[model samples]
Target: MLAFGCTWLYDGAMSRSDRFEIFLAAPPGLEEVLTDEAREMGFGPVTAVPGGAGLTGQWTDVWRANLELRGAGRVLARIGSFRALHLAQLDKRARKFDWAAYLRPDVPLRIEATCRKSKIYHAGAATERIARAITETLGAPIAEDATLRLMARIEDDLVTFSLDTSGEPLHRRGYKEAVGKAPMRETLGALFLRQCGYDGAEPVLDPMCGSGTFVIEAAEIAVGLPPGRARRFAFEDLAGFDAEAWQAMQTPRPPRDTPLRFYGSDRDAGAVRMAGANAARAGVAALTKFTCQSVSALTRPEGAPGLVMVNPPYGARIGNRKLLFGLYAALGEVLRREMRGWRVGLVTSDGGLARATGLPFLPPGPPVAHGGLKVTLWRTGPL
Candidate 1:
């Protein structure tokens, strides 16, 4: 599987403006949605791959993606690649790699490796080789707990090196200090909202909102707030990061004066309180409203009809499987009876539970991995 005459090696003298491959890690089943976002955001030559979206961009594009894109779960910068059939070959080539070009010698790094369809079968041994090479050749210390990670993927006898530009998963979003059980991730919520045709122009409501993810995300989008504005990234520790430029690029955009309001309601008063606190931390409390109420009490907010997005309790994660059917039926009945012109997007793992809602759902979207179960987004036309 080795390509004997081809090599993509990093040059230490390459400037930040030089173009290279950047991969935006996508949540399972959400690659297309992310690709569309990257295209709309003007990332060039974007393509949807198996697990992520691939694009060619400069360092600034990397920074902008980490700062702006909502659907991307993480960003990886693919610096270079080489052919290595075995451990000794990997060691030989890795020791000669230009690690100093991107990584700071004073900063600690963690190496992770994956092996597939290659002779270098031991991921641990491969990681040890790469780590030792970086330490001996470039003086970078390897650490287990370091936020900056260098990922090595050995597939088809090719060793490709990528830096995890995002230290933590993008879902953290830095504002959610409190989360309820089975909370939906902000990244996944954003993608679902995109699939539902939400463009920040209309109001949003979540009946089973946990931690107010949907409500806060919708509000932030409406107000033109970037998702990564409240957080730090691993790219700041790279060798060539420009703090002044990054700060300048992120000069806060005055939130547009959106008259729209986002809403979340939950039966658990504690969840409601947590959602409010999270909204406050995200700087969107003024645009969001949270309440403690059951699904039966859900009423249409006074405004133009918008999307009603919900992630209800599924049997696998929440409570008794048999009892959730009644809950689903009740939710369906309420939307049909009360929400006459609003569209509905329901996320659940059990098709039976989704069907129990009795909503005239269009075809379901791809199954997404959530809380260890595959959940599908079920959508319906205006009810």
Candidate 2:
């Protein structure tokens, strides 16, 4: 809920000498989008890894990442890594590890562990060993409901420890309390926007705006707002956190604006109303418009050609998925007839639903997980 001045944060950026590994998580298929965003936000040198991007920076960098990056699901600070052949070795190394470097002795920590191709194959036991180390040596208590979580990952006998700096996933944004079934995660929506080549200069229209995530995100992008500006992060509880420095880093900037407006249309009237309310909560209401209307009734507003991104129902769970193809085709017919010159980004778990749209789409992006379904972003050039 606070901000820092650009100067103060950048100074911290240059001031840190002890750089730790910072990993920014993204949806599986959208790692590249997060990588691009990380570089654009000045986190470098960044390497695009399998699940996210890896970079090295000081604790200040860790806080800034949790504050600024819109595309990352979570920001993890890789505290340290070591080799451990078994549980006793892990316990010995963990006991010696400098937990004070990141965790505060007074703060409770929740530990999560994962093991793969490692001699210490029991992840739960590994977690308990690390938890005991922190408790017995560092004096921090283990708690089931702790706000701060430490992740212990043992892969191929290498025990790597990381702190979940972002607390709740970044996409929660602490503002969107109103979401319909299959609500697109704000982080996922932001990545999809990037994949669609939206730089926030263009107007965006989400035809099936269940909770208006796409429209709100587009407006936020256009206005240069920090997605985490309204939320608290786990990093605030770490030993390295500086309240003054962080506040300075979060210094408020004048809200940026664009002349172009983003729009969303949904047939569910209550959803339309909720989206509008959510937009106001996010401080993007002035630049965004939500309406209760069917896709068949969608019309292009008076403006330059932009992008029309949609996340329509594909019946992945309960409904007759076959019938949804006709809906896709109808929505495509609407865009094809009404929205010439505007690019399209459609999210659906079913490729057939995408193909049914009949819009001239390029190959889809990689499959991304959404509400237990694997979906991809299908794109098109200016239609």
Candidate 3:
């Protein structure tokens, strides 16, 4: 039991349809993509928000979101929502909303507040006001640095508060001990895999598999491995986290032993080693086979024609564009020579480099933000 202001509440046992609200955050322009992912993972009535989506479901739904949603960066539990016209109104409402139900007094917590198009225009002052209110009303000490964070967003006079169920970003799957100079996030890798229509049935190859993200994500998807299986989530420390239920949801059974359907090769041997280690941590090393080879040395695996996806180094970070044009030309030559009839997806920040591949791609769609750079996923082969 915990007490906040005059309202004290006990931790109630959760039911199957307890109506837990989840707020899913994503990169810009990925709200709809994440919403669709939530619905596919059994979340109902998913509604899109500014930087995320909201859905109503149970703890199991939360588990599913954490495990399966590919485009989401973080999933938060909506604790409360209201409209606040002033600091007093916000403080009074916050005191009455039963924060004790979600947080423990002994556990250190931090408050993060954002104000936009509201009466409270000063974000820093507003944050301080709310923090003081919570501390004074609830008698809970506010630590400057706390692992448990309560996020508050004020949009058009409406205040939405949520608990970050994912402390670290969900993409840090605790696999890649070493990352390349420019590495793709694990969530983006998974989403791109889904966008490319990779079902794990055929051979999947990433010719320029830096840090092996695409290849590892493909192996996980192919083997039905849950993306969060290798990581610890913030929800694990919440009041009513069910460890047993979470453990039971781990992949259910061993990966189905398919042939060498996942393959990755890179010109950098160090990247190859890192990829192998990441694959091993993901428990998909058996499904994936990595080699220290260049794009020119690419070979098609012995299986049904499948996806050939690559996130070649763009000039934005590593590799000079002038030098990469030759590399892209070599890749184009290799793809034309070896990988006919195989679907191809390329992620690049530069249109010229993508065009250099000469794969007859569909017109590039709107850019998606990746690592502070605007990038697009260009697809070719059979629409």
Model 1 vs truth, CA RMSD: 2.4
Best by lDDT: 1
Residue-level lDDT of model 1, residues 115-162, one tens digit each, is 999999999999999999999999999999999999898988988888
lDDT of model number 1: 0.90
Candidate 2: regions farther than 4 A off: 1-16
Candidate 3 lDDT, tens digit per residue, 33-139?
67777777777788777677777766677777877776778877766667788888877777666666666666778888888789977778777877776777666
> In model 3, how many backbone clashes occur?
0
- lDDT, candidate 3, at 266: 89
| Model 1 quality (TM-score) | 0.96
Candidates arranged by TM-score, highest first:
1, 2, 3
lDDT of each: 0.90, 0.85, 0.76
Clashing pairs in 3: none
Q: By summed lDDT, which 10 consecutive residues of candidate 1 come out lowest?
A: 1-10
TM-score of each: 0.96, 0.93, 0.90
List candidate 1 segments past 4 Å from native. 1-14
lDDT of 2 by residue, 59-135 (tens): 87888888888898888876666789999999988888877767789999999999989999998899889899989
lDDT of 2: 0.85
The positional error of residue 295 in candidate 2, measured at the CA in angstroms, is 1.1
Q: Which scores higher on lDDT, 1 or 3?
A: 1
